[model samples]
Target: MIFYGKQSIAQSDIDAVVEVLKSDFLTQGPAIEKFEKYVAEYCGVKYAVAVTNATSALHIACLAAGLGKGDVLWTSPITFTASANCGRYCDADVDFVDIDPSTYNMSVDELEKKLQKAAVKPKVVIPVHLAGQSCDMDKIYKLSQEYGFKVIEDASHAIGADYKSAKIGCCKYSDLAVFSFHPVKIVTTGEGGMVLTNDKELHEKVLLYRSHGITRDPKMMTRTADGPWYYQQIELGFNYRMTDMQAALGYSQMQKVDEFVSRRRYLAKRYDELLKNINNIHLPDQNEDTDSSWHLYVVRVDFSKINKTKQQIFAEMKDRGICLNLHYIPVHTQPYYQKQGFKDGDFPNSEKYYEEAFTLPLYYSLTDEQQDYIVKNLVEVLQ
Candidate 1:
């Protein structure tokens, strides 16, 4: 019964959802704005816009970054499909940068090499914080400056994480950041997301885009107001608004983000110590001056040294009820991306990661006993 990842719901979260259900406003109400405020403050960012999901947040973030038809959007290949799909949704060309073998995030070195050899400069770059570990954003932001591209940090796995002693969503290293609140994430709102930005203009643009591109405020209106019931569709946008019920659950969950992270940290430390001597497996990496939220607890298997294959190990773990998983397959190798002209050998490092990576059970409520059982089964299977 130990799933790879699961939401930890508290009594407060349930009560908050119930309160929202009993309230007069269910969809677009005070709770939504309240949740936004909570996230903004928590991340140390100036503004935040709540949305239906991380995918929608990424889409709007791309729009706010001025991506459109004929423009090129670049991101790491080792991420969920949503990271790259945001660009396609804007009718832009999408490309990928390979990842660093050690951290499993986009490599600044590869990004620089790609820029040097490019005939067309990318207009947007999304650096994903895979598995709640922040990417090397300062270096990426430096390249962004030299190349004149906007950056959207896809921090779906890194809500409470920190880079260089600052919160991940602070926008200190990128133009904007997106966070997920799906059930498996550190925080849960049933299904929700938020985009963070310090730039007032981008914040306003996202706000406008969240609600069908309709603006009721006079300042953003392109024309004179018709009456008190006046509103305008300033741009073509989507119905990406989050509901008050979800926001209420998020708000309550936000109160426990620190506690959740602490428990995950403790569990991760235990795993590190317990498995440190296993020569055939490597633990997750931690860069200098950063702390991850320890989202997935992915470990890499050295298949060349082991008697069994990754497939065999995975099957054994599952058969023993460990519920192991892989964080991703290289996105460029997906059928959709292959049709876009990307194929095997386009990104060797990401493909290599796909071959060896495996995710262990990670969540706030995973007991020490459960984790030990999981690791014991994995070790025995590997032998």
Candidate 2:
């Protein structure tokens, strides 16, 4: 069976993990520092803090942004729960902006409209780069300036993605950016994430919060330590540190990031060529100024031209051994968010996207033959 997305692991990745296993330090070793430095250099950022997963990265990023009670955080309604949940973790109000119909990223117009009408402005805005495509961060950054809010790029699906001629994690347009290395993402570290920033204090905050708010540095310590081994818990934090094993794997994967992106782009091009005129389906749209990592190739079904429901298409695809999936179901439509007074029609564009869109298989290791087979089956089903 084909997957919607899968990691492309090679021998080098395995060797890196094995070497870490034989080393003296299994967790919090030199490899973690090396991986962080490598990612920072790649993204052209001043700092990168490694964490256990993207969720932890987002949570710490929110905390670093000084999000708290009496403040509000906004993100796209089409994103995974972590994007909004991070704000809730900081005890702040969480809200969502509708997505752009074409890009499926946060709508800058809607953001401005919301900010303009609000009595209290947002403390932070987390614009998600959905489906591995970079959001129009230039516009979002301009909005942040006009509205006086900090920007956090929830770029979990955009590790190798490019935005306005620079890498997504460069933080050129946002105060901080996040990346994920889950098994199904562009790269895998057995579940890892990184937060990137140019702000010195924000980087330090992430470091402190990742390690239970403990600090051993004399400069950061409130008082002198009695012994060299003494450390202080200066702030409340969680143990979100990445392990040496995961770091080693991530570092190795970093070496092939460009290669992986290139392959995914090629696959997306092939899909574009082969599926151009399928009966009731529309391919993903691309921005001329940005390049996508093509993590998931989502197509929209034109229900007006089709007799079958999206639910039927998904069920039939699954029965045919093709694992079709939706990018999201509108986070505000989730039961938990509904309790927060968010309901079905709150974000119309995102809810409409949920009704029409489903992901096609797109991954580093997907072959042309498999793609063609999957497409043929899909075309036949639509026919």
Candidate 3:
């Protein structure tokens, strides 16, 4: 069966891992630094801190931004739980912003309205680049400046994507941006993530938080201690460091980043062309200023018109050798957030999206023939 997402590994990637295995150091080594440098340079950011996963990266980023108790964090509810959970990790109250129907990212208009009536302002606003399409960062940045709130771009799906001709991780539009290197992402580090920033202090804080909050840097120490062996625990932190083995894989994958994004875009274009004529289905739209990485090919099917529930359509597609999946359930609708006082109608746009959306097979290795087969199966299911 054709799966929704898969990694594309080359002989060079295998060779890089083999080389790391033969090396003396495996975890804390030059490879990790090299990978960090590679990503920083690629994204045109001053620093990039590699972490165990995107969740850990988000945790450190939120903490570094001074998010904590009494602070409220706002983000799009149409995302993975990690987006909101990161705020909770900092003891900050989490809130949701509705999404734009076209781009499916956070709606700036909804955000402005919420800010106007908000009893308490958010300390940070995390705009997720859902499905690799960027939110309107210029507008978000303007709002952030006016409201005096920090912006953390949850760009897990947008590593190779572009916003206003600039790379997504450049942090041009936000205070900090995060990227994922999971197996299904544009690149794979076997389960790794990175945080990018231009501010030296924030960058340093991220590095400190990713480790045990201990610092080997003598400059950052409160007082000069004994010898080179001297170190100090500056703040509370966690073991969120990415392994050198994973970094090596990421370093190799970085070489073909453009190719991976290009192939995905090509496939997305084809899918759009094929699905445009099909009724009862809605295709993803690309923002004029944003270049999407097309992380997942999600479509919204009007179950009412198709005479089937989403589950029935999904099952039919699966039986026809298509391994389809759903993008997400609205974060606020989850049991945990329900306790947070969020109900069904809290965010209408997100609830509507969750009800109709499902992801189709998309990956670097998906052949045109496979795509045609999947599309054919989808057509049959709808009929």
Candidate 4:
């Protein structure tokens, strides 16, 4: 069966991890710093802090930005729960912004409308780069300036993607950006994440927060104590540091990021050409301005024209050895959020997307033969 997404591991990636295993340190070692440096250099950001996973990166990023009780955090509903849960991690009120029906990213126009009617101003706004296609950062950046809200880009799917010729994690348009190195992502570290920022203060805070808020740097100590043995617990933090074994794998994978992205883009282009002729299906959009990493090749079915419902289509595809999967459910529709007064109609576009959108097979290692089989099975299922 063709998986919807998967890792592309090689001897080099395996060797890197093996070398780490043979090294003197496995966690909190030189490999972690090396990996962080590689990502920071690649994204052209000043600092990169390695974390256990993207969710932890999001939580620490929200905390570093001062999102807490009495503050509202806004994000797109069409994303993994971590995008919204990061806000709740800080005891902040969470709210959803509808997505653009075409791009499936947070809609700047909807955000503007919501801000106008919002009883309280949001302190942080997280715009997810859904399916590796960046949200309109230029417009969102303008809104951020006008509304005085901090921007944290949920760029987990977009490490190798470019937004207007700028790397996604450069933070040229936002305060901080996060990337995932999950197995199915552009790169694999088994499970890891990184936070990138241009601001020195935020960078320092992220480093401190990722390691239990304990600072060994004498400069950051609250009071002058003994000798070099002096240290301090500056603030409450968590053990979110990524292991060196994971970092070694990430470092090796980072070397081939361009190649992985290029392959994925090529496959996506092929899928786009083949699927465009099909009726009752909407393919992903990639205008000349936005270059996507093509993390997942998603298509939305027009249920009105198709004889089968989404469930029936999904079941048929699965029975035919095609592992299709949905991208997300509207976060506000979750039972936990419903108790917070969120309901189905809170974000119309997100609700509509959840009903029809599903991801098809996409990965660097996926061959043309596999893709052909997937497309043929999909066509047969729809028929």
Q: Give lDDT tens digits, candidate 2, residues 152-223.
A: 999999988898889989999999999999999998998999999999999999999999999998999988
Residue 122 lDDT (model 2): 92
Q: TM-scores of all models?
A: 0.98, 0.98, 0.99, 0.98
Q: Per-residue lDDT tens digits of candidate 3, residues 129-189?
A: 9999999999999999999899999999998999999999999989999999999999999
Cα RMSD (Å) between model 2 and the true structure?
0.9
Worst 10 residues of 1 by lDDT: 310-319
lDDT of 1 by residue, 1-383 (tens): 67999999888889999999999999999999899998999999999999999999999999999999999999999999999999999999999999999999999999999999999999999999999999999999999999999999999999889899999999998999999999999999889999999999999999988888999999889889999999999999889999999999999999999999999999999999989997788898998867999888999987998889888887888888878889899999999999999999999999999999989999999999998998888878888
Superposed by TM-score, candidate 2 places the C-alpha of residue 186 at a distance from the truth, in angstroms, of 0.4
Q: In candidate 4, what are the lDDT values of residues 75-130, reduced to their tens digit?
A: 99999999999999999999988999989999988999998898898999999999
Native-structure RMSD, model 4: 1.0
Tell me the whole-model lDDT of each prediction, alpha carbons only. 0.93, 0.92, 0.93, 0.92
Q: What local lDDT does model 1 show for residue 333? A: 95
Candidate 1 residue pairs in clash (backbone atoms < 3 Å): none
